[model samples]
Target: MAEVEIVVAHRERATLRVGEVFLKVDADRARADAEVEAMALAPVPTPRVLWRAPPVLALAALPGTALDSTASPAAWAAAGAAARALHDAPPPPWPGPSPEEIAARLDRECAWFAADDVLPADLLTRNRRLADTALRPWTPVFTHGDLQASHVFADGDAITGVLDWSEAAPGDALSDLATLTLGREERLADVLAGYDADVDTGLIHAWWSLRCLLVVRWLVEHGFDPRPEIAVLEARR
Candidate 1:
């Protein structure tokens, strides 16, 4: 029998790896459903669903390492191209949040962080100011809303698969690009080369600040380290 390896575990969800399959347990079935639907709709490669039982979704393990380290520039570019392909695909009909909604979220998170004292006021203030540009109107795209480096898996210079679709939705295209290159600014050129489109790098930076600021509270409350996100926020200064 294969030893069960815990991929991630928290109150709301957990994932375990056993042999070649990964079992995801989500307290919220809607998120799981969304993930499945998004994967099915996505133009890029996604993990194969082996089976499903309410609250437990079994997926075949993808065969590549996370894109955080030892990934060639070609692989990084491939990931970007994959993102572009997904964006080009028809977006889900369901509406995503508007700029007003996003601004409200930023205000709420910023206020909470300010009062909590978990983050320095200056850091919050600066990033909050930087987040302004990202609030502008954007043509929605089918976005992997949480497209971080770790969520992308690459085999050499080719992208094998992208993991975690729970947050997929129609949103700002730059948000996806920003998330992919977050904390890895050095790789921006390669990714953009693959993206092959005119993008406002400033807006990408703004999203970087916005996302990090918004996610800090959730990460802290969930008992996960928020340092990486905070680092990104600080960089905005």
Candidate 2:
């Protein structure tokens, strides 16, 4: 029998890896549906779907390890190339958050942070001002939506595949760039080099600030320290 390992679990979802198969169980069926559809639509390498049942999805494990801990600039470039391929594909049928929606979320989350005193008021203010740059109109592209390092798999300088399509949708390409380079700002140039189009540096920086600020509180609530993200935010100031 294949050994079953608990990958991750939370109130909303859980993942179990049984040898070469990964089983994802999501409480929200819509998210599971999106994952299935997004994997089918994406042009880049995605984990092969083996089977699915409501609230659960089974995927064949990709060969490489997660890219989060890799320090190679070449690997970063490969990840960027994969991102470019995905963006170059036809847009998913579903929509992503519009600029206005993102701005609104920032506003709401900032208010919560202020009420909770999560960070120094001045730090939050500075970051919020910087975030304004990312709030403008953008040409939408197919986006990974959650392009965390853990979701990308690389073998040496080559990208094997990207995982977790649950948040996949149409959104600003910079969002994916920013997400991939989060806390690892030094690799931004390498990633951009592999990208298909000219990137707006200001928007990427703004998204970084916005993203870090928005997620800090959530990280803390989940018993994860937000210090690293906070350090990233402060460094930008």
Overall lDDT per candidate, in order of appearance: 0.90, 0.87
Residue 210 in candidate 1, Cα distance off native in Å: 0.3
**TM-score list, all predictions:** 0.96, 0.94
lDDT of 1 by residue, 9-44 (tens): 888899999999999999898889989999999999
lDDT of candidate 2 at residue 196, scale 0 to 100: 51
Error of 2 at 214 (Å): 2.0
Q: State the lDDT at 138 in candidate 1.
A: 86
lDDT, candidate 2, 1-237, per-residue tens: 889899877677889999999999998988898888998888888899898887888999998788864558888888889999998888899888898888888998899879988778998898999998888888788999989988999888888888998889889888899999998888899889888578888889999998987788778777678898888888876
Report the number of the highest-TM-score candidate: 1
Scored against the true structure, residue 195 in model 1 reaches a CA lDDT of 96
- Residue 214 Cα positional deviation in candidate 1, in Å, after optimal superposition: 0.6
Superposed by TM-score, candidate 2 places the C-alpha of residue 174 at a distance from the truth, in angstroms, of: 0.2
Error of 2 at 159 (Å): 1.0
Full-model lDDT, candidate 2 = 0.87
In candidate 1, which residue ranges exceed 4 Å CA deviation? Answer: none
